[model samples]
Target: MGGNHAATGAAAWIAVTASTPIAFGWYPVSDASVFTGALVCAGAALLPDADHHSGTIANSLRPVSNVVVKGIEAVSGGHRKGTHSILGIAVFTAIAWALSLLSIDTGDALFGAILIGPGIMCVLLVAFALKALKITRDTKLLPWTMSVTLAVLIAIFAPEEWYWMPFSVALGCTVHIVGDLITTNGVPLLWPLKFRSPYWMRNKRGLELDWMWRAGGNLSLPILGDAGSVREWIFLIPVSLYAVTGIVWALLDQMGYDTMAIWYQIVAALPF
Candidate 1:
């Protein structure tokens, strides 16, 4: 689930960025923004899982993470409850937005470009994303090092604009929820606002839509049957390919390669 969510996050970011070779132009495009936003999205994709005490994000740090996980679990009314809901997305985005504002008052950057608040946010979140992606599971040092290095680079070279940061967080979380909706257990997307199941939903044998009302509206589609199922893996193939392709294309374009021309050549060379 973490891997799938992470890939989806990157793909979602690529889909929104105009700077990428295959995307729309919702936000202003830049080499730095493109990559930074993708990483942020990947990290935020795993953010909702913090509610699960035994999940990846819970043990992401150590004792501190455990305490934080317990707090979130309690406040969120257990896993797949508040943190998986629309309200949770709003709360997460608001927090990210607030941290982004901290950069505005920073007359002197941390390293000539790094804003303390956003820089710290990026470091922690990006580190979490690296952890969730299992980029270096054998040792935690690598991810932390990579995150710090990226943060410093962003501070030094990336632009100061972060208007798109909070929304990226929101999009990542929403993508996570969507991922859950495809699973058999589903998620309470509308926490604390359960409704009676309609005739169609009530008649379904496996899904207890009305029964789950107390926990929240457990809106699910069950297309993938269950988490980590073989069907899920099959579904992830195309998504993973898209994420990889977008990332590679973005990087190539950043390195000044003519991606469009290459894509055209690739198409032309393909067998009919």
Candidate 2:
């Protein structure tokens, strides 16, 4: 899938999952959390690829990303290896958990702020262990780790909201992973232990934008599949429909026909 497709998939999944807990009456969530959490997760899903020099995300961070990639390549024996390794997962998880502490609404004592971050880090480590053991590979479940980590966060800070919040967050992120798996090369939903997954998607013929260079300034403006053929139009319609439906749904929901807003989803999911 293309970057736009992948990102949209992430957004749709987040919207669906975020609504799950709210609809089920788990906890009262401010819109900010929902938006923040979704974007955070979607960002994470897109992020792993940043370990690669030529990836869309890698360039944005530039020299720092370059340094990280070089370091990982030195250690993992190549660009994607070390960063994709279990060791790297641990490192990144710790970093993210430590960073998450900054989001807490209440202040902590000096020691509390410092030690608390690592404590949160420990919880994230445990979640990663759990996913590594139980979820199986190639499923969107890897992203579920984001939800589980958030669950631990909820448990500590908003105990009452713990029940369904993680479920919603995981669902959204997993859906993004699932969307990607539909393409030719799938993810190892179950990693370390179980191996790969069964999901397969039809890969794109050509995405207009190409990440030929890793230097932040080189990504090409994506050209839609050719504008000249019937086949191109074939890809265009569904793509157009997908984009428009999302827009329409947002409009209707804003217009107060929220219940009717899911019409696009039904159409998208329909087996034509």
Task: Indicate which candidate wins on TM-score.
Answer: 1
lDDT of each: 0.76, 0.39
lDDT of 1 at 221: 80
User: Estimated TM-score per prediction?
Assistant: 0.87, 0.41
Among these predicted structures, which one has the highest lDDT? 1
**Could you give candidate 1's per-residue lDDT for residues 46-87 as a string of tens digits?**
888889998877755555667888999999999898898888
Which 10 residues in a row give candidate 1 its minimum summed lDDT?
208-217
Q: Report the lDDT tens digits of candidate 2 across residue range 1-272.
A: 22333344335433453333213324334433444333334444443444455653433333444575555446544433334334445555556644444434345542122234433433333332222223322334443455446545644554432223333333433443444333323333333333321222112345322222112221121233222335434544564354334444434444567534365666679999
Please state the error at residue 170 of candidate 1 in Å: 0.8
User: In model 2, what are the clashing residue pairs, if there are any?
Assistant: 136-190, 137-189, 137-190, 138-188, 138-189, 138-190, 139-189, 182-200, 182-201, 183-201
Residue 203 in candidate 2 has what lDDT?
28
